[model samples]
Target: MLADSSSSLAHGHKGRTGLVRILFATRHSLAGLRAAYTGENAFRQEIWAASVMLPLALWLGQGWVEKALLMGAVLLVLIVELLNSAIEATVDRVSMELHELSKRAKDLASAAVFLSLVLCGGVWLAALWHRFVPG
Candidate 1:
């Protein structure tokens, strides 16, 4: 029943509706996590950092909003890193040659990751200051 454009956008998953689509998506997502954890050293390091920060966020945050903000920031770093890795991988897959566009794409993705880390650090510092420093 989909239009031509909609059908083309399905990416061959037209038959996978409802529960089937959800299950397939979950499986693919888990596979991505596994691949990122195993293959990307930065991702592994971020996972380790998140393991520590998540528990600390619970203790340091006095309320739900603080806790969520702290936790979300940490997660944002991981999300950005994953995206960066994916972009790099795709660029590399296209060609290993030293192309300007490839370099720019990788650089842009790296900047995104850097920005996410800065955001995470700022959020955590603000939380710590709010908790410990007298205003």
Candidate 2:
């Protein structure tokens, strides 16, 4: 039974396929996005920041590479935040009781979000510096 199920998944034969799979995947992704936005303050804040930064990226960026990098950095924050939120949600769902391992998991996820924010800030700062200061 395990072999059959594994093989089915490996072959993409046990579930939705083709356009149907794509549609389902897209729906699921949208639901996740909605959930993050509704339930997570950090995610909502980052999303709002992205809403502003993305347009600024297009305007301030000197070229395609700069624009892509600037936009990518902002998006990275959102991605990391979403992952962190998922981890936190799963930990909470498992047990509300205080546990050392649970604390570690939440702390690690928070650290990941912080690092992503730092990277995004660095990228934006570099772009601003390059735009305003000539060497």
Candidate 3:
């Protein structure tokens, strides 16, 4: 039975092929977004930040490349945050006890999120300086 299940998994039996797989993937992605938004306070705050930054990215950017860079930087934060939240959730699901490995994993994920935020801030500041400052 284990072999059968493993073989089925190897063959992509979870969502099958073609349109069914695409639909299932889309559904799962939406569910993940919903779960993150509803369950994660940090995610909710980032969503609000993105809501403001995305439009500002469009308006403040001087050209297509600037716009893309600004927008991508903002989105990158949310992506990193989602991954960080997923790691924390998985670690907690495994065990709520104070384990060094789990703590390390969560901390590393958090650092990734912090780096993404730094990158986003740098991009935005550069753009703002370019637009407003007399340099």
Candidate 4:
């Protein structure tokens, strides 16, 4: 009974360990990125934006802290998008038949992504304004 309970806690297979777990985790992380890039158009779009903004952030930023903040803001958007995608995937996986709770979850996730985008935009604008605009 203890063994059964432990296995259940591990969510089946008793979980991975040591180097094997590290390798598995890396692979799973890459797969999640690939799936989000391929399946989620918004994620793909954000990736493209990040590709541009990340380098620009470095070039435009005056100091290490500024650059880090710029990069972090962009990364936050990506992180939120991934989480939103995961939420959407989980909701869909549970059932395709229209349901209110599923809609609520998905909508909330989407709103999170939108807010992340807004935050990213605000950060970039502030950085650019600080650099280019005379104060």
Task: Estimate, for each residue in 1-135, the C-alpha lDDT of model 1 and write its tens digit.
Answer: 537866765776656778888999999999999999999999999999999999999999989999999999999999999999999999999999999999999999999999999999999999999999998
For 12-79, candidate 4 gives per-residue lDDT tens digits of 44377888888888998999999999999999999999999999999988999989999999999999
Q: Give the Cα error of residue 124 in candidate 3, in Å.
A: 0.3
lDDT of 2 at 40: 90
lDDT of each: 0.96, 0.93, 0.96, 0.91
Off by over 4 Å in 2: 1-14
TM-score of each: 0.90, 0.89, 0.91, 0.89
Candidate closer to the true structure by TM-score (higher is better), 2 or 3: 3
Per-model clash counts, in order, read: 0, 0, 0, 0
lDDT of 2 by residue, 1-135 (tens): 257777888886557788989888899899999999999988998999999999999998999999999999999999999999999999999999999999999999999999999999999999999999989
Residue 99, candidate 1: C-alpha displacement in angstroms: 0.8
- Model 2 C-alpha RMSD to native: 3.2
Pairing residues by index, what is the TM-score of model 1?
A: 0.90
What is the RMSD, in Å, between candidate 4 and the native fold over all Cα? Answer: 2.9
lDDT score of residue 16 within candidate 4? 71
| Model 3 CA deviation exceeding 4 Å by range | 1-15
